[model samples]
Target: MLYFLKHKLVLLATPKTGSTALEQALAPLADMVLQGDPRIKHCTFQRYKWRMEKFIQIFEDEPPQTAALIRHPEDWLGSWFRFRHGSWLNGTTRSTRGLSFDQFVDGYLAEPQPAFAAVGQQARFLTHPKTGETVTHLYRYDAMSEFVAFLGQRLATTITLGRLNVSPEKELRLDPALRSRLEQRYAEDYALYDMALDKHPG
Candidate 1:
């Protein structure tokens, strides 16, 4: 939302891909920052469908440059899970009642719900929403250093990389079985990430 409001760049803030870092870097440059709910990654189609006309009207009044970041599906999910549940450094708590990685994968595969699926989907939509116009830039999280440089050039300001928002030492303790299951669950996301990597080739 900072992208759209300030640089006129609509950034599709993908989850667990160093989005918080990007937001911080851009904070000084932004005209306004609109944060999404911590629970929901982005404004979903279903949620906005009811007010689509009004949303478009609001956009019509805004400037146009937009950008976003995306990451490999498995990596993104791993980071998300770790940040939300496994991060001992940040005092995060593992949920005792939530579905296991395998179960979550099953649900994700059965239904690609935006809220439940990977964050890359949000990045894709930001770049190419159902409304049709492509975003000005679509950045890959793996190439964040370069992307940051690009932003510096565009915004004409220097940016410094900071520590990740949620760093969990406990992530090291995650079972290999669970890790593999999560990776397998986000196989499609891996493919998409590969495609993005290929396109950028940094």
Candidate 2:
């Protein structure tokens, strides 16, 4: 996560959603940055509400405005599948090597997801557990230009981002039935992504 003390902006890092690029692009301008640890770097809005915001309120009347990016649910899971399918992890149980995209998603839908498909949901990461509140602003993962422009305007600096944490290329297709199941199981993520796209149609 990256926070700009002067701008009062907090950019929450949603996993696999260009967060690494944002961190690298904004770190030089940010007052504080949390990285290296998943729990810290990917801290959700709910955690920020009770912990970080509580502390920030000690010095300011209001907490910083929070923003995050959300990806299409299928694309998000595809990224995870290809990332773990890299040759370096071929022999590990965590690897998705040799597994079809459908199988990987099936693992995700399992009651107890296997290690390979245990990625957390974007909707869950962005929502407040108690109040059901999400971030103040949400950008679409596929719409990088809009997000970049917003950052430039808010931070008063031109921003550039390099691709980072890119997953391997793979054909990610699912049967119609499997996709229907995915949509049924992860409807909230789809809805949230649609909302973000509508908000920032870049």
Candidate 3:
């Protein structure tokens, strides 16, 4: 799908939202891959902010069409917390062990940091960036199949739907108190995600 575009597709990956799946699926299609810091699977907010111009520069010659994959704030944050601090993977638990989700949310809210800020802040670049105009097409992690179809049409190529990063089958049961806290913690992100979801093609 990306190979057909050659230089026309720029995938600005957002972390922990099935970005790896998208990367694997589209790797064959991309002429150049812009993998971010190894510490972060995709671009951190700081990195994206600092290199927005360079990213824009990549599109100068042919003016590539851009796309990004995003996830719901609650789910994305949970995955990020688990991946960064929890025991999901072996030997990756040193930094984040024993940190409560509330504590993590509090720390994220208190600072202007990369990878820990609100998901809405991370997603703002999809619509508006400090350096340049925002890209038009975006894919919500929740609606992968529809996004794949949309991409297929735009790129005039076939895109196969693959395994999502988060499984819907095994639902995370959050206590009411915790759910409310999370909802409050990510209110802005919820609103932004709603707007993006509304804009998605039916």
Candidate 4:
């Protein structure tokens, strides 16, 4: 997560949603940056609202506006699977190396997910911890151009996002039946992506 005290904006670093590139790009301009570890980098929106807001209040009088990025549910899951399957995790419990995408989805839906399939629900990450409320300024990762444009306008600066993962994209052929449950689990993720542009109007 990144905080621009001058702009009064708090941008969440949603996992597997191209947050790294944007965070890196904007890091120098941010007044406060929370990153370099999973617990810090992927801090949930609710956690900040309830806990970290006081920390920022010392810097600025106004509560920062919350914003985040959401990738399509299927694509997000696929990225998670592929990310852990990298060579560095060859023999680790978190490795998806030998598993099919379908198998990964099955594991994700299991009651007690395995290390490899334990990625949390996207929508749950952005919801308010106590009230269950969600933010309106969410943007779609697929529509990055529009997102960058929105940010440029809001922050009053130019934003040029570069590709972070240039490796040839792998084919993600998740089973249709398993995909239904995947969608069900991340229903709000779909809703957010669908109406992202509306939430982040020009």
Candidate 5:
């Protein structure tokens, strides 16, 4: 995550939503950058709320406005499948080496997900567990231009992003039944994405 104290902006890093690229571009301008542990690096809004409360106590200032990205649920899962299919994760429980995209989704939909398909939910990451509210600002992963323009206007800097943490190319076709199931299960994420697209149609 990147925190710009002067701008009172906290850009939450939503995994597989081009966060690495944004971090590379904006880290130089951020007052604070956290990327050491995957846990802290991908810290969700619910978790960050407590951290920010303590952080702002020193300054006696309100917490910064927050933002994050949400990708199409199926595409997000596809990225995870391809990412874990890499040789780097071979032989590990997290590896998706032998699994097809459909199998990965099946595992994900299971009550107890297999390690490879155990990626956390985008809706949950952006949501406040108690309040069921999301971030102040949200952008779609496929809509990078809108997100970049917002950053430029908010931060008053021309931001340029480079692709990072890109997964290998693969044909990830989900079964019709599985696709429907994904949309049904992740309806909140789909709604949030639609809201973002409507709010920032540019």
Candidate 6:
């Protein structure tokens, strides 16, 4: 995530949403750049605001306007599966080498998910911890050009993002029943994605 002091904007790093690539392009220009641990780098908008309270009170005088990117629910989960299945995780519990896309979705919907499918929910990640609110601005992962354009206008600078940390190519053909279960279980994710779409309807 990056904070632009001059613009009072906070760019949240939503996992599997090209955040690392944008970070590379924008970090040098940010007032504060949060990196390292995934938890910190992908900090929720609410937590970021709370964490920066003292800084805002002392310097900026108010919390920054926050924004985040989100992918389709199925696509996000598929990315997690493919990423774990990559050769880099060869012998780890996080590897999905022997699992099918259907099995991965089952594990994701399991009461106690296996490490390979235990990635956190996108909706929960974007929600405010206390107020149950969400980000001030939301962008679709598939509509990156729109997102970059919005950011360019807001920050008054061109943003040139590049591919980074891409998951390996994998065919995600989920079983009909299992896909239904996933959609039902994670309905909130789709709901939020739809909400974002409404914001920038084409």
Best by TM-score: 2
Model 6 Cα shift for residue 65 (angstroms): 0.6
lDDT value, residue 159 of candidate 5: 89
Clashes of each: 6, 0, 3, 0, 0, 0
Candidate 4 worst ten-residue window by lDDT: 193-202
lDDT of 1 by residue, 123-168 (tens): 3443335554444566677788777776777677898978767645
Q: For residues 1-202, write the lDDT of model 4, one tens digit per residue.
A: 9988888888998898788888878888898899899889999978887788888887777788888888888888889888888888899999999999999999999989999999998888988857877664788887787878878887899987777843336788988899889778767678867876634463
TM-score of each: 0.61, 0.95, 0.66, 0.92, 0.94, 0.94
lDDT of 5 at 176: 100
User: What's the C-alpha lDDT at position 121 in model 2?
Assistant: 92
Q: Decide which is better by TM-score, 1 or 6.
A: 6
Tens-digit lDDT track of model 3 for 31-111: 666554543445544454456436555656545566666677767766666655533543542344555666555555655
How many Å off is the CA of 193 in candidate 5? 1.9
Query: Candidate 3 at residue 9, lDDT?
Result: 59
Across residues 87-198, which tens digit of lDDT does each residue of candidate 6 receive? 9999999999999999889999998998888999998888876787888889889888888888888899999988899999977898999988988999989998988842
lDDT, residue 20, candidate 5:
89
Which residue pairs of candidate 4 clash?
Answer: none
Worst 10 residues of 5 by lDDT: 193-202
C-alpha lDDT of all candidate models, in order: 0.53, 0.88, 0.58, 0.83, 0.86, 0.86
Query: Per-residue lDDT for 1-202 in model 2, tens only?
Result: 8888889999999999999999998999988788998999999888888898887777778789998899989999999999999988888889998899989999999999999889999998999867889998898987878888888889999998998989988888887888999999999889888888434444
Worst 10 residues of 2 by lDDT: 193-202
Q: Write the per-residue lDDT of candidate 5 for residues 1-202, one digit (tens) a residue.
A: 8888888889999999998899989999998898868897888998888776468557746778988888988889899999999999999999998888999999999999888889999889989889987888888888888888888888999988887899999998889998899889879888877876523545
Q: Give the CA lDDT, 0 to 100, for residue 128 in model 2.
A: 86
Instruction: Tell me model 3's lDDT, rounded to 2 decimals.
Output: 0.58
Q: Tell me how candidate 4 scores on lDDT.
A: 0.83
| Superposition TM-score, candidate 3 onto the true structure | 0.66
